[model samples]
Target: MSENRAFFRETVEQILADTLDQSRIEASERRMLPAALYKALEENGVTRMLVPEGKGGIGADIGDSFAILRAMGAAAAPGPIVETMLGNKLLAEAGLEPADGLIALAFADDGAAVLHAVPWGGGVDHVLAVTPSGISLSASASWEMEAALDAADEPRDTLRGSLGAIVALDTSATLRTAAILRAGQMLGAIEWTLARSIDYAGERKQFGREISKFQVIQQMLAELAAQLLASAGIAEAAADAGRETLIAAARSRLGDAADAAIGIGHQVHGAMGFSKEYALNHRTRRLMAWRDDFGSVQFWRRRLAGGFVTCSREEFWPAIADAGNRRAA
Candidate 1:
């Protein structure tokens, strides 16, 4: 890893350790991390990791930002680091002031769901709403907050306001950026789930032996570990790749990772895993929710397949290679 990435990893890990305080709360409580953790991040400049130094941000590279986000996911911190950083980057790139609060790109259900301008409430201060046409932003509109469906089927309130300004820019780049960040979060979740499951298995008893000693248990753990590692590798590679390629890789790897981690984690924990009292449920629930957040596994798989089918093999290889080169440069 580069020095910047290593530093980012260390910084985020420390922040998560201090803020998460494993003994004080369970996983369910973690969902509130974004609201609770926001102050610390703002004070520590964590939220500005991707913003330019001149713009009061840490000006970290995309790879560095991904590392920090992954660590946050591992700790199950509920902050909107990915949304803030990426949104800020997009706004700054667009020559606009970075609006405050959590800014996320919303995709219309219409199959195209590209970038279309839509009015959003001012409560969020910033938002990226995508339609089939292009990206749109509303910084000054009054927001009306109402509950909306999140990836996990939980009711997440969305701020609906007027369109202060609409910019019809191709959002393929922005969509790709969001996908890479989301993939990093998934990687972190998989890592944390696998480690926690292993720890639980070693301590929990079954059939007069530690559950970890059982061949069946060991096999499950092995599979979970493999999935975790594989997903982490793919996510890291995707982060290193530029936008489009990152989206493609992340769409596939993140979904697989989330499903595998949740499946094996619940299996290892069994009945206890389902209980809200158990900390495992927190991670598993989020994993389930996150899998469908930006897009579901099936959604991305179809997207990747469709893209591949339309492009020649020669063209496809070059696209992937170009993404890698951009990251290196």
Candidate 2:
């Protein structure tokens, strides 16, 4: 890793350590991070890391942003980090001011459908909704509410109904970026699950011996570690590939990691893992919910398969070679 990226990771790690209130986060679940935490992040410009310096942001690269996001996922910080950061990048690229609070886009199945802005909570100053076709800006409108599919209990809602309007920015790149960001978040969750499970096994005892001493327990941990490492590598490679490549890689790995991590984590902790009082449960639940968000594993798998089927084997090799060369160079 570059020194700059190391520094960026350290900076985010410190910010999360110092500012994120674990007690409050555990209590609220999905209800946005505390106002104080949000203020601190905003004051430090963590929330706008993707925007250009000229646009009142730190002008960080995607790699740096992903590192920060990975830290957030590891810590399990509440609120919509992917949605907000991607929205900030989209707005900056569009020459618009980055809006504060939660910002996510709502898209229809039709390829040319307009995306509408949905706030994280009830109200925000502005919302930017971008689609592959174009960018849409709405300042005054009643935000629609839909139920979130994730496990977080805090204020989760989706956007729907006629109160919302869509604009066309044709920004497929931004949507792809958001997907990559989600993959980073998944990586963090997987890492946390593996580490936590190992720790729990070592400390928790069964039959007068440490559970970690058991071959069965060790195998599970080893498998989770391998999956986590592979997923992390794929996610990083995908992010470097840009847009669709990143999304495909992330979708493939995150789903597998989430399933493996959550299952093993619960097994290691046994009943404790399912208890709401346990921290492991908190992290695992979010992993379960997030895996389905953006696009479910099945959804992305079909999409990826479709893409591959449409291309001849000859065409696929060149695309893979080109992507590898881009990352290498």
Candidate 3:
């Protein structure tokens, strides 16, 4: 089983290596969907990765889904891969077959459904209207995407047209699933940022010595490495346990890693990191944007606080310890 997982991981890595070239990243950043790359993901079964094979899908578990998400994050594959995977899972949960083509979160505002900061919203054929009432699938109201600054530049669009059909499912489940997926994506972002930072630090010289040799630079790298490991652990635990609190913690931890790693990444890259032409921004911008994607740090922090409030003073330490014990195991 482990070997199978390893092979899948390598296969994903190779696919991203071949598909997410510099040209595609730039085009995606410009809010344009790389049609070929999107089709490649579909052909490889990633579009239906989370759905069961019996349902005309791949039937991949959360672990496999997350692995693919992380690879996309690392490669800066821009589109609705995450949205499509989670949306398909939710639809399957409701025993509803998702409409073909890409899918995105359908944000609710009053009576209308809207999508804000939607990745590749313009590129998708369907906008998933996940509301408190139920889950509704709407055809792309309009591909007329509004503007966004984050170079991942996933076109954000609003839903104006009438909804087709809706399903009954807990809204929290969708949020938790999306949040967990975002956390996994952060793992890839942090890793990609660290890889770039280390490479730059080792190559760029200061005072006839590589920047990587400096104690300050080394310390920052070490801190990012430690945080990345913790972030990965939190994400894995949340995926395994399905605890809302753990999921929130994973998102919070990911936000923390984004804060630190984004700083260290740009610091090592100097001015070039922020330059529009540089590849570092492709990964780093997404990290920064995703920190607040599903839920910001403050939001998750409040969610965690609510969870802890249930425990009495006497049970506090035990509760915390038990959670840690479970994570360790």
Candidate 4:
């Protein structure tokens, strides 16, 4: 990481450490936004981290912003931080003024009146809607919301109304960016689970000794670690490069990693892992909820496969080679 990136990461970590706790997280899950936490994030420039420097943002690189996102996931910080950051950037890109307070992001078909399962939809200041044709922003007062929750118990409300005039833009890039940033969140959650499982294994004794001593437990942890490593590498690269094919690959690969993290992280802890009071459950449930956000694993898999199948036999290897090239010109 660059010096600037390190500073951003540390600042996010400190904010999370100070503002987030069990009660606040639980409150968010119950559909109450953590107002103070969002305030702190905004005060620290995190909310506008991606907008241009002249526009009151840090003008941070995509990779640096993504690192902060990963930290948010690891801390299991609540609310729509990811959406707000990207929404502000997109708003600036369109020469539109950024909205105040929280922003919720959603995708709907062109000409659609209702947007469903929008993250933090009911409580945001504005909604940044991305469609096949373009993007638009609408104030919260312009729409009606039916409150709901996702598997993670976070707000995933439905909005019924029209967004403002759509500005022409590359919607695919918008969706890909959302998908890969989500993949980074999943990566951090998986990392937390693996670490938590490891710690539990070391301290929790079975029959005669620590569960960490068992060959089977060691094998499982090792396998989970391997998955986490691979997922992290690809997720970071996709964020840095913002390549469509690479983002597809990262999302698909992280789906597998999430599956492993939930399985192994719980299996090691036995019944204790399933309890709501346990920290492991928090990250695991989020992994389940977030895996299909922006797009599903099957959608990305099809996207990845579709990207390569269009190439002739002679162009196949180079295409695969190109997708993995993070710094490709």
Model 1 TM-score, all chains together: 0.81
lDDT of 2 by residue, 26-85 (tens): 755544456666677778787798999999999988878788888878888777667677
lDDT of 1 by residue, 304-329 (tens): 55545555877877755554343211
Q: Report the error of model 3 at residue 174, Å.
A: 1.0
The TM-scores, one per candidate, come to 0.81, 0.86, 0.92, 0.95
Worst 10 residues of 3 by lDDT: 320-329
All candidates' lDDT scores? 0.66, 0.70, 0.76, 0.87
Which prediction has more favorable lDDT, 2 or 3? 3
Clashing pairs in 4: none
Question: What residue pairs are clashing in model 1?
Answer: 34-78, 34-79, 115-131, 115-134, 116-131, 120-161, 121-143, 121-160, 121-161, 122-143
Best by lDDT: 4
Ranking the candidates on TM-score from highest down gives: 4, 3, 2, 1
lDDT of 4 at 175: 81
| Per-model tally of clashing residue pairs | 10, 11, 0, 0
Clashing pairs in 3: none
> How high is the lDDT of residue 247 in model 3?
82
